[model samples]
Target: MEVVALVSGGKDSCMSMLEWGNDTMGTDELDSFMFQTVGHTVLQSYAQCMGLPLFRHTIRGKALNQDLHYAKTQEDEVESLYVLLKEVKKRFPNVQGVASGAILSDYQRFRVENVCERLGLVSLAYLWQRDQKELLQEMTEVPIDAVLIKVAALGLDPYKHLGKSITALRPLLFRLSDEYGCHPCGEGGEYETLTLDCPLFRYKIVLDETEVVIHSDDQFAQVGYFQIAKHHLEPKADYDASLVSGGEGIVYDVWKELPDELPQCTEAEVAVDAASTTHGELQAAEPLDISLSHGAQAKCRGGEHRRVAAGPTLCRHKG
Candidate 1:
């Protein structure tokens, strides 16, 4: 079961795939209501660093319908995923599901699940509903090199914390969680992260210079964005990808509480790739007009971005 991973160049998205230990075959189309466009300009570097092809689709719709249960509508953001996945499926026919890093967003989960169901793809939400502290522990334990790019919390200072790795901010995060009721895992939009290097990365992204753009300078909550100005990819020594975090990829059937539309996936047949284009009505939909796209494909070569290491919490549905 090859899966098309949905990456936003963030920690959870990176970690979600890490949890499954699957190599992402592709990624990114900047700017959408559903995805983080910040640091999106460098998203292709992820695919490049991992030696995988990158697919893209410009989002042309807004979050028109915010219902807990998603139903497609014309000019809606959810439809963009539907179309993008359809195109991915068209390109990579072996893809069986999508990998997401969603931990607490039912809004996001429903929309993604909706798209997967329509296209016969499984929603591999490995981090769904997991304990936040544990998730953070696992991310840092596996040690994803990630930094805060955006901060919007009462205790967090974006200018001070921007470009700082999450590992370095753990104590502060825990302190803030106790003092200000902040989300330790940032599930509450307190901040957003960009993974500079992870097990999935073939090379590490190094920042030479940066410009911090302040969105809000409030006393309680200061919102700032890191406009990464100078960066380059530096090659790293190869190591065993599977042993990075002892994570195996998530499969659809491994989930207990799942919708009936999702197929019964087997470990023997579950893996993640990028791209899904099987929406019946979306088949003829016009392609989004965007130039931030790439289509080169690469097979995993040991150290290449490839294969999943399933985590410890796999649950199977009773047949």
Candidate 2:
């Protein structure tokens, strides 16, 4: 089936296109479509990088008022997309389905499906219902070069992380997910991403400069975004493909060997470990601490100091 991909210059959209391409290879011709929303025509660069013909439409209206409940409040946005697809259909009459990057947002998926239904186009949401964590890991494994462009959630430092690749932020993102219930793939509007490079891209986008725009700052959370000051697409042949293909094999190996049931550590075990050492006992043990600056002395059970050389050391002494 020939389809039009709905791109937003983001990781999810780009990754969806790559997956759709992989799935429909030899059977479908992929074209791209996008609505010029807040980010302007930056997505056009992405479409160009992918070497896909793009159909773009500018959305003209007051910003859709986000309601307390998720309904058809954003119908205007969908309508804009509807208009864009009609134009796409006029250009590519064989287009049968519309590709969407929706993962967990029913609001987004429903709106796109509604428009597709009206236009007699099938909505292809390949990323829908996939495990978020696994999806994130796969994204990195595919070596998708996506950077955080906007952030508005707790536990995220947009200043530090803005424009950093998703691969670099994987561990931090998972940590936030585990500790603070952050969406693993930013599905909860915690952040937004822009794809710089992917397998589908013929060229890779390089940022020459960017400006950090901060919207809010507080003790608990900071909200900010990156504005592209300068950017250009570089020929893929200019870089070493091996370095660009970072840890793809390692990620695949780890994912494939993952167990159905992951190991669980009980809270009781944690409490028992904590209870093993009282405050006073811990204070006493602190004095036996080995100075990490110099070669540390390991205190044995017999109270003998054994000199040990250290570049990096992990010392655990039981009293």
Candidate 3:
């Protein structure tokens, strides 16, 4: 049976892909699917590296405001996922099943299942209810090169997250889970991730460029902001997760934080060309150090201006 896995370049999604090769479903066959979001380049690149036939469904982050405020109610989730499923149906006309990397969030699972029921797309939760600790261990064992992209939890700071390697983050996540009740793999939305290089990827994603943007909230003490970056894939020279750990990316802060609607970036101008050479090697690269901004750009330590038009302004910050 042709299937599409809702990949996020996280442990669960990678596990789902690896599971496809195993003869668990006997005669049932497998295919791959990915849900693309603007900030999730690592996962998208991972899918390309793996040579998976991917169908991307775009969802505006702002559209999730209602769900975020209302706790992802059934109606909210169903409506959102319905849009995604409809797009998937158009691409894979005969898709028999839709796989997810869902682990413990019943809210997330229920929503996906509802979409599948509506579209006649079987819902497969391969990583549901498994031991959280064990799952983290497996992620390390498989050694997926994932990095934390956003952090909204107590124990995790933007510094702890932005450019840290997944393996480095694991022990801290484990400690957070043990002490502060944080979800081990951030299932509770404490954080989110992006996979750069994984076993399933055909080529490693190399991040060539980046910029920082703020998404602040009045209600929260620590406002939310993220580093946006561009990635490209290239053939693997030698498979080593640690080699790519150094290029984990950068972080910047929000100044004069307000609760206004976050601004969007100018659309990425680069096109994906299969023949593109590795733009920058990931081996032994350094994490980007950027200062907070009050107006249009973030000041980077390297003396280069990282532009952020109407997104975040650097005004008085010095580079």
Among all candidates shown, the one with the greatest TM-score: 1
Residue 137 of model 3, lDDT score: 82
* Reference-based TM-score of each model: 0.75, 0.67, 0.60
Clashing pairs in 2: none
User: Residue-wise lDDT of candidate 3 within 1-319, one digit each (tens)?
Assistant: 4555665555566665455432111111111111223244444343335443333332212223222112333322134345544544564465566666767655445555656777877676656776888878887777777776555566666644665667888889999899988778766655656667766554776666755333333243222324566678787877553222222122211212322222322233221111121211011011111111011111122332232221111111121
- The residue-by-residue lDDT of candidate 1 on 1-319, one tens digit each, is 4656688788888877665544444444333334565666567566556655556545555556756678878767566667667766775787766777778777677777888878987677767787888778778888799998777777777668988888999889988988988778887777778899887766789888888877656666766777777789997787455433222221111112222222221222100100121110111122222111122222223332322232222221211
Where does candidate 2 have its weakest 10-residue lDDT segment?
286-295
lDDT of 1: 0.61
Superposition error at 124 for model 3 (Å): 0.6
Cα TM-score of candidate 3? 0.60
Candidate 3, poorest ten consecutive residues by summed lDDT: 281-290
Which candidate, 2 or 3, would have the higher lDDT against the true structure?
Answer: 2
Ranking by lDDT: 1, 2, 3
Cα lDDT, model 2, residue 171: 94
